[model samples]
Target: EDKVVQSPLSLVVHEGDTVTLNCSYEVTNFRSLLWYKQEKKAPTFLFMLTSSGIEKKSGRLSSILDKKELSSILNITATQTGDSAIYLCAVAAQGGSEKLVFGKGTKLTVNP
Candidate 1:
């Protein structure tokens, strides 16, 4: 199945460390970019950047999309242990036809 993969697989950070989670994908007829934060429960939508919304930010988390490059990046600043979780990246086709193809996710661990 076409999919995405994140590097490092996991990360460790202190109470106030900046981190960058990477996501690389390979899907059919790429559509848009999606980012979610997974913490025990299902992932919660963090950002959805289509051709219309290519960049998004909320507090300490921010992300950008590059359709031409066929990749995206997510950045987090002053991360805390509460920020600890698996960050997931997904790709969905236009018109929302197929399921959201997901990456293996990057597990982030924050230490106090």
Candidate 2:
């Protein structure tokens, strides 16, 4: 089985604040790392990171992958109430079909 852990399982922050979410994984045959934000419906894809690239950025959100530490972190700047959601970290294996193993996730609540 895959081992994935997320720190600070929950967080509460005010608007304009910054939050850092962490995820560490020890999955055999790891192929890539992925981040997702779940608000209500389905989870929305945020970023996908592979061994070749260690960092990804999209507007006020950025993520980094550390191969040496086998972990990844997501940073959200200028948080807003709309940003409140469950942030999930998943890892895909390198087999024929990608099987994603996900962590419990960190629930972020951005207050006004």
Candidate 3:
């Protein structure tokens, strides 16, 4: 079985504050680690980390993968009200029907 878990299921941060989202997993034949930001309809891709040490970054959001530890972290800097969303983490499996198995996600609220 492949599974993913996220910590601090929810968070409240003030505008301009920084936050870190945590995700840990136990997976079989893990292929990659993916991060998504969800506000309404569906999750939007944030980062996909496959190799260790290298980080994926976009503006105020960044993430890194740790294959050896079977974990990953996402950081949001200078958060704004518009940054409020659910952060999801998933692991990609090799040769699996469900390409990715996801965590319940961490809900973030940035107060302006």
Candidate number of the best lDDT = 2
State the lDDT at 102 in candidate 2. Answer: 90
* TM of each candidate vs. truth: 0.89, 0.94, 0.96
Which of candidates 1 and 3 is the stronger one according to lDDT?
Answer: 3
lDDT of 1 at 71: 79
Q: What ranking of all candidate models by lDDT puts the best one first? A: 2, 3, 1
For model 3, the stretches where C-alpha displacement exceeds 4 angstroms are none
Better of 2 and 3 by TM-score: 3
Cα lDDT of candidate 3 equals 0.91
Per-residue alpha-carbon lDDT of model 2 for 1-112, expressed as tens digits? 7888998899999999999999999988888899999999899999999964457999999999888889999999999899999999999887677689999999999999
lDDT of model 3, residue 102: 94
**Per-residue error (Å), model 2, residue 7:** 1.3
Model 1: residues with Cα > 4 Å off, grouped in runs: 94-97
Cα error of candidate 1 at position 67, Å: 1.6
Indicate the worst ten consecutive residues by lDDT in candidate 1.
48-57
> 78, model 3: CA deviation in Å?
0.6
On a 0 to 100 scale, what is the lDDT of residue 22 in model 1? 82
